[model samples]
Target: MSAPLSRPSYAAVLRVPRARSTFAAALVGRLAYGVVSLSLLLATVRATGSYAVAGTVMALFGASTVLLLPLRASLVDRYGPRRALAPMAVLYAALLSVLAAVTWRPGTPAVVLGAVTALTGACAPPLGPTMRMVWGELVHDRRLLQRAYSLDGVAEELLYVSGPVFVGVLIRFASPSAGLLLSAALIAAGTCAFVASPVVGGLRGSSGRRQQGKSPARQRGLLQPVLVAAGAGLTLSAVDLLVTAFAERHGYGGDTVAWMLAALSAGSAVGGLLNGAIDWRTPARVRLPWQAAGLGLTVCAAGLAPGPWTLTAALACAGAFVAPALTTAYLIADETAAPGARTRAGAWINTAVNAGSSCGAVTAGLLLSHASLGVCFAAAGGAALVSAAGAVVGARGTAVAAVEAEPVPEAALEAESGRSGA
Candidate 1:
């Protein structure tokens, strides 16, 4: 039998300057997102006095983000992130101030709050995708790109997991409004620094080509993958909501939710590291199913947890699959996208994630009001299973295509031939 294929080494991918700059930008943006996200969730609950209402507010917020993500991505691609980031940051801060002002009136109509929330969501810059694209452009070697993506994924997990705990502590001692205000300040400062960075400035002058013609129908078609990705995101979000609700029902309290979520983030960080380290010769189709299976199993096991600690463990296990899923989806989008559609593809994925999370939250709230938390967990678990099945199918197709593709470099072909001849 031929010798087993060896994976690409990380050493092959480590270019210094670009990697450092990408990491710095990603860290700054993630920190800003983390602060804002945690503050928003806590403040909404404090202001509304109902988890259901808070979920709704968050749903509206996500809806706005989903709607605006493509537009934002396009702008980033055209004008570059530096030019687009500043105004978005300013608008986001201003909108948060409005949200902080209106939040005190408790009796203020939900409709008004929702509108404001939507505006806040809309103003959120597509920082994650923009940064990812920057990494893709900046990193010349494929192996390095893999490492950069892995790093990006880790940063995301840290942001989400840590941000909430920090905000929760602040809200416990100070006030939720204070947390929100602080979030705004962080966003402003981070975005400003990111914009001012020389790396970003250099990118500004590179290109202004619109990816596609200004046809609405064509744009919609191009966005179909994003829509599918969004569906997946919504399902995952629902699972998260269910997990949180279930934890609370078991007398875990609000703080437990933070810990459980953190577990998931930790798992994701591990997954990202693994994804970066493994130079799989197998096509994505072979890998995607395993990733999805891990995610599904983790969700299902979470329902079997005996207590908060067990639940946290299960969620953390589930989180291990999160980054791989995200990475696979991004890779698929990159491979499948038409010329000039990269930004849109990235934006769509972000939109799907936010949209999915929003839907999940709403669904969890409804289920919590009527059914036992166990039912919600089971439902979420089932959804994850379904996602796994879909991923498997997609992976098979991708693998077949890869197998039929043209051969690689002469060295690679020779290596394969040599192994076979041996």
Candidate 2:
């Protein structure tokens, strides 16, 4: 038999010199998004002095963004990233500037704010999917690509953790407008730089298989991964609600809850890194259900913890399974998507996540009103268990293992291009 496969090192996988600038730029854009919903919510509340209006504004923006993402990704795939995103970047900035100004007007109509938010949401870039697609283009090795995604998962968690803090600081030291202004600036800069990067600048849509008369979007296996992603999102939101209720009930300070949440994020980042570093040799299809089940069960167990510290530990344990599950789902999406439709595929995964999170929050909230915290936790676990079932059933007959088993020629090309100094 051939030798056993060695674990892939993340350092070696990400050492693509030509890809660094693009990755960094996309990262900034992604991180900027972490602050947006919260900042806008705060801004809307400050302006209208009504939580209802603020909630409506934020909800519209989120829903619009999710609805428009597929279209945005399709545009990027049809045209090139540079051609598609550059104009969008400019328009997004202008709209944000307008929003900042409009929010300061006390008499601004809710409809007017809704329209602005809708337009702004439509303009939001598909940076997350774009970056991942670029990596698919830059790195051919399946193993290496997995590691890259792991890094991205870690970055995502970190950005979400710190982005709110950044926005809060800006709001504290400057004005409410400051957060929006900086977010606009960063998005603009990042989009411009990302589109100009060598790997993405002149890239065209993958029309090869489309010309051959097969559609990747219509593939049978795509729905499973999207469902899996949705399940992961649901679990996350459920846990968030659980922690919030736990803290409030126990008289724990907001800082304590934040630390507990931080521990979870930290565990996810660490798990993602470890998952990426080692070639577990398990197909994503096989890994996904187990990961989802693990997440659900962990969260359920956390509900049994007697104190904040115990809950924190349980959350961290649950978090460890989060990124690995997500990474697997993403990998599944990448593999199953039709050529030229990769961006839309990624967007679909995102859409599922958003929808699932909203559902999870609602479910947890309703449960919290009538049941003990443990019951809410149990429900969350049930949701995850359902997700795991979906994964198992959804992944039926997919050849993910065979695909990953194929030799990688892309990594060889990437290595020859240049290595990053990072």
Candidate 3:
């Protein structure tokens, strides 16, 4: 077993052999994920001259991307990222390029465009899950993995922030189609480079082999992490619309909305870094509910702010909980994955967060129609409380023992990696 360090620096994570190159390539490919939605949404809206048409196309696209992620992830676990990711990235890029050309001028048929968008979304490579899986391989020491994931979560938040800014720049100078084409180029080039890395290149497929009888990922332990993740997603997604509504209600300008959202992102980034810097003795399963509840409470508190600046402050506090909750959940998911199921395990968390976000939009819309802003905030926070309570119940109610009660040794994790490869 690897000895636990007092505290592993985030710099130490990057120092792991081959980690920097693999991580950089993965980020380049994943940035395309961050960029595509806004780029495509704007392009579709411009092409159809109708928000309704664009909305439908985007809905289809998002649904395909989130719902089929597990299937895509399973392929990565089975065949390894080198083989699985490159082909998906190429096909996905090809579709996006087609979309850019089709949406260049107005009056494209909605159904035709929707078909292409859905196909494009379906082909999205599970880069985030695959990258996390690679992190598991690169760092066997638990402390280093914790630092690595925290660093990853923080970087991902920054990527989403930067992706929108990149799209905005394109819109300022060129067309939205330029962002789409840029997304295409990034994914194709980045994925090719990612696969060529020595770490990824060494992996092999043993999909049919039963090296492990049944993965713990298939057991009951995944429920808590997945549920908490979904709850976190729900509250976070609701904030976007809720803040906009608050701004409109107060007669604040659109920039107020942007500032509050940015505040929230800033908070998350700081929180993620802080979370990574610590070396906690508590198990992740023990810590998850507290983190979930913190997010819930802070968000509810944001609803009580009397002015825009106060609201920004409250949202920033809420944001602080976001990254820690997600990083903890991913840690649990990684621990649970076992053998040839790493990618799919991470994908489950991804799916829950996204599906919850989709639901959250509709939820906020309904609340805004019938309830006061305070009520909407309370209800969103209340959802997290329920999920936090449910995770505890779910863990105890199931027959399987709590997998997180004890740490799995590094040697066993190594065996898991060997089983996943040839």
Using TM-score as the yardstick, the better of models 1 and 2 is 2
Q: Return the clash pairs for model 2, or none.
A: 216-338
Give me the runs in candidate 1 sitting further than 4 Å from their true place: 1-15, 41-56, 102-112, 172-174, 204-235, 248-258, 305-311, 364-378, 392-422
Candidate 1, lDDT over the whole model = 0.68
Q: Which runs in model 3 stand beyond 4 Å of their true positions?
A: 1-7, 211-218, 398-422
- TM-score, ranked from best to worst: 3, 2, 1
Candidate 3 residue-wise lDDT, 179-199, digit = tens: 999999989988998889988
Candidate 1 lDDT over 121-205, as tens digits, reads 8888877777777666666556556666677777777777677767878877876767667777777777777767666666652
Give residue 71's error in model 1 in angstroms.
Answer: 1.8
Candidate 1 residue 295 Cα shift, in angstroms, is 1.2
**What TM-score, to 2 decimals, does candidate 1 have?**
0.77
lDDT of each: 0.68, 0.81, 0.87
The positional error of residue 31 in candidate 2, measured at the CA in angstroms, is 2.1
Which candidate wins on TM-score? 3
Query: Using Cα atoms with residue i matched to residue i, what is each candidate's TM-score against the true structure?
Result: 0.77, 0.90, 0.92
TM-score of candidate 2 against the unseen true structure: 0.90
